[model samples]
Target: MASMLKDLWNRFAGGGNASVHEEPAAEAVEYKGFRIRPAPYSAKGGFQTAGVIEKDFESGMKEYRFVRAETHPSKDEAATFSVTKGKQIIDEQGDRVFR
Candidate 1:
């Protein structure tokens, strides 16, 4: 009964179920040696990436690199680019780049 009224109200409001279809959010993709994780959709109707970098100077000392897809137009592209860059950095810096 409640659903019927809701459906009737939707039809009257011009927001009938016929015109309502929710699109599934984009899933993260992994490419090359990088992992691309999808984030929640933004108000602008697209997802935005979040980048984080961590470094520890205590004990064994460690540095972590976390680059998100914010700079790239797509998540897969970002992951590939980031991984390539990371590989270059590691190759150049060696063990100093991490713990």
Candidate 2:
């Protein structure tokens, strides 16, 4: 009887375990109208990028425009660029715009 009770207790205690751990949700940062993924690297050896948001200037209507920059590590020194004009991509140069 004691052995049966111990077996029952162990079975209940270790019954079909599910996931032990779960992955954390991704972290994001927003700047202006862009949603930057993860966190921006430090300026020590990081590159900066820019994005623009506009409405439908292409079809002569209203729409949403979203642009993002490339991610750079904290060791490479290079320029990044992104451009958008009214839900349409324009030109990008060194993470800045030229008039």
Query: What is each predicted model's overall lDDT from 0 to 1?
Result: 0.39, 0.29
Off by over 4 Å in 2: 1-44, 56-80, 84-99
TM-score of candidate 2 against the unseen true structure: 0.19
True-structure lDDT of candidate 1 = 0.39
Clashing pairs in 2: none
User: lDDT tens string, model 2, 54-80?
Assistant: 322344533222323343553122112
17-72: candidate 1 lDDT, tens digit per residue: 32112121234333333333322222123333332122334464353333232445
Work out the TM-score per prediction.
0.35, 0.19
